[model samples]
Target: MARIQIDLPEHFGFSTAIPVYLSHINYSGHVDNALLLTLVTEARVRYFQSLGYTEMDVEGVGIILADAAVQYKSEAFHGEIMDISMTATDFNKYGCDLLWRMRDQVSGREVARGKSGIVFFDYGTHRIAPVPPAFRQLFE
Candidate 1:
């Protein structure tokens, strides 16, 4: 069997702390696999907001999640604050990979690492849009 490996960057451009709630836990007493993605989604929103953009509008175009991958390193329990850090890399014609890592805020133990594929879209034209130059410049 093979496992998914996520190579994180040395430095992250954005980070936010999100606490695990009871609802985020599963029957086994750890953060649910699905909800982990939710935590990442929250961090993603804040990342965009920090840049003064929203998921629906980034440099005059919207963004969509093309794909995602997660590699869990440890379990996260309720009430524990998770520090998620993120950065954009692996740019293409219409999208780029948003890489992230999650760690326990107190112990600094890594919980998970992953990347989400984001694609720019034009709502009016109903087609994939080119990565906005202004948006690309921010990370370059």
Candidate 2:
């Protein structure tokens, strides 16, 4: 079987720092694979907040993560600060891809690279919505 390969962008539109806690460590003493998803989730929320939006209120529609893929590079240990960078790409009528890269802040070693496919959703109607123009403008 082929492993998932994520080619991260050279530049990211947003970045934030998050500290790895003991809870994030697995039995092997490094950050767990599952926990990296949570880290990216946090970063994604923060990225939206910085764009003057929230998970439930971006450009008059919420967002639903359609899918995700991650490629692990190095182990991240507890007490280490992870630098996460994010950007949007692969736009369609109703969705786009949010690319992310996580690295050890101090050593500058890449920890993981991933992308989440996000689609605009109308929670009230329980259906997919078109990508908001204002939201697209942020990257334009």
Candidate 3:
């Protein structure tokens, strides 16, 4: 598995934290695997909101996840706060990729690392299109 370190600056963007609860626990009494995806996904939602990118704006040439992968390196216990740092990288004509690093807020240990490919879509025309200048402008 490949891993990379992402430096988060105060003004770069926003960060969201999600707490793991007993409901997210599995039979093993640890954070469930699917729970990790759920937490990371919530972080992505906040990331989009932070960018001021609404679903209406992405209606036609919106973004879609091309690929998503995560590797669990540590276990998060119930009631542990997970800080998910999201940043936009590799922005281009099509879309931008988001890199995320999730760690236990208190211990400061990395629990998982993940990446997702977001693609520009032309939902109206049923074709793939380049990201709109406005959406691209948010990062610039």
Candidate 4:
């Protein structure tokens, strides 16, 4: 069997802190695998908002999460503040990869790292759209 490995970027352009709620913890007394994605989703939204955009509107085009890959590092517990950092990379014609890293705020222990593959879409035509040049330039 092989393990899924995610190579994080050297620097992230955005960062935010989110605390783990009791509901985020599983019976195992650690953050649930599924909930980790929820945390990163929040970070993703903030990342876009910081750039004056949203998941549904990036330079007049909506973004659809094409795929996601997460690599958990350490167990995170309830009440722990997770510091999440993100950046955009791997540009293609229609989309780019959003990479992120999560760590415990107090302990500074890495909790997870991953990337979300995003694709630009046009709601009016219900079709894939080319990446907006202005949006691509922001990360480049």
**Where is the poorest 10-residue window by lDDT in model 4?**
1-10
Error of 1 at 131 (Å): 0.4
Winner of 2 and 3 under TM-score: 2
lDDT of 3: 0.77
Q: How much does candidate 3 score in TM-score?
A: 0.81
Candidate 1 structure quality by residue, lDDT tens digits, 1-140? 89999999999999999999999999999999999999999999999999999999998899999999999999999999999999999999999999999999999999999999999999989899999999999998
Clashing pairs in 3: none
User: How accurate locally, in lDDT, is each candidate?
Assistant: 0.97, 0.95, 0.77, 0.95
Report the lDDT tens digits of candidate 3 across residue range 27-129.
9888998878888888888888777665335534567788876777888889999999887777877877778888899999988877777888877776778
Per-candidate RMSD vs. true structure?
A: 0.7, 0.7, 3.0, 0.7
TM-score of candidate 4 relative to the true fold = 0.97
Q: 1-140, model 2: which lDDT tens digit per residue?
A: 99899888889999999999999999999999999899999999999999999999997899999999999999999999999999999999999999999999999999999999999999999999999998987787
Where model 1 places Cα greater than 4 Å from the true spot, the runs are: none
Per-residue lDDT, model 2, residue 138, is 77
Q: How far does residue 68 in candidate 3 sit from its true spot (Å)?
A: 1.0
| Clash count for each candidate, listed in order shown | 0, 0, 0, 0
TM-score for predicted model 1 compared with the true structure: 0.98
